[model samples]
Target: MHRHTRRTVITTLLASSFALSGAVALAPSAGAAVPTASCTVTPNASGTSVTIKGEGFTAPRNLNDGESTVPLSVDANGNFQVTRFQKNVDYTVLAVKEDQNFTFVNCKVVKAGDTSGNATGNNAKDAKRGAGDGYRAGRSAAQKSCDVKATPNKNQQHSDAYWKAWQTGADAAFNRYC
Candidate 1:
């Protein structure tokens, strides 16, 4: 009985030590930092141009402006800047980092210098509504065998937001139907 008790205590101590070591091994190291990314867009030239600044991104960064993707250069501190980025419509800018990690920010380029703080939301709503309307119109044009084009008419009296949205909708409709 004495021998068995001694053996049991020894086994328990060994098992406990092994479990503690395993947990320590599995713990994350203090230097194992998580990757991060961010971006900001500044409208320029009445929304015709934009300056995008980004930080916390690794090398091989790229900027995706909903319409095109352009490679970017990063400084030693993992920051990037894109100046004079041409843009006509409001854009959802994406900052892509290594290994497909990315972050996105919406830029309201159409309403330049509008500091109302509601421009982004309002523009999004307008774009949504315009897309819907354009889609419907495109469907109708397809049914009527009319040319479905997204080109804005100079004579049409519509808000820039609305017209841009309409063009997008019409173009999408044309692709799907015509």
Candidate 2:
């Protein structure tokens, strides 16, 4: 009876190990890929107030809010929480992977009113270009370019279609990154 009990235990352990190994196979190979990271950024009454909630901040780093970067301190237990996010801007997580030596983009930060609502779109970015320093270093340049079409052999020249396409991409990029 004792021998039978020991044999049963050993068989069960072996079978479990095989099942566990199979699960590992389902996961990406070591250093071949970065673990998919995810997070959510919540803001307080103040737009600048933010909290970052997620996992895998292996080595705590900084989070950027377009205008500046802020240091992010992760808890010893691997929990990360921040208390300030830029108002009306996009934010994202940038972290270095323990393996693969690549930065993992677990998620992007976003807020309403970051982009323009115009059919032409980019009206916000263009406004930002004029209202503040962007693209051409300030709002004036962006406004001038709103009606600008290409002049052959000159810099910043493109077709109306090109500009429209650029706006589409710009909108998508902000949505994707932020």
Q: Give the top-scoring candidate (TM-score).
A: 1
Clashes of each: 0, 6
Question: TM-scores across all candidates?
Answer: 0.36, 0.35
Per-model C-alpha lDDT, please? 0.60, 0.46
**Cα lDDT of model 2 by residue, 47-108, tens digit:** 64655554445565556666776666756644466666354566666564455222544434
List the RMSD of every prediction in angstroms: 16.8, 17.2
Candidate 2 lowest-lDDT run of ten = 113-122
Off by over 4 Å in 2: 1-35, 45-48, 96-178
Instruction: Name the regions of candidate 1 deviating beyond 4 angstroms.
Output: 1-35, 88-178
Clashing pairs in 2: 50-83, 50-84, 91-109, 129-138, 129-139, 130-139
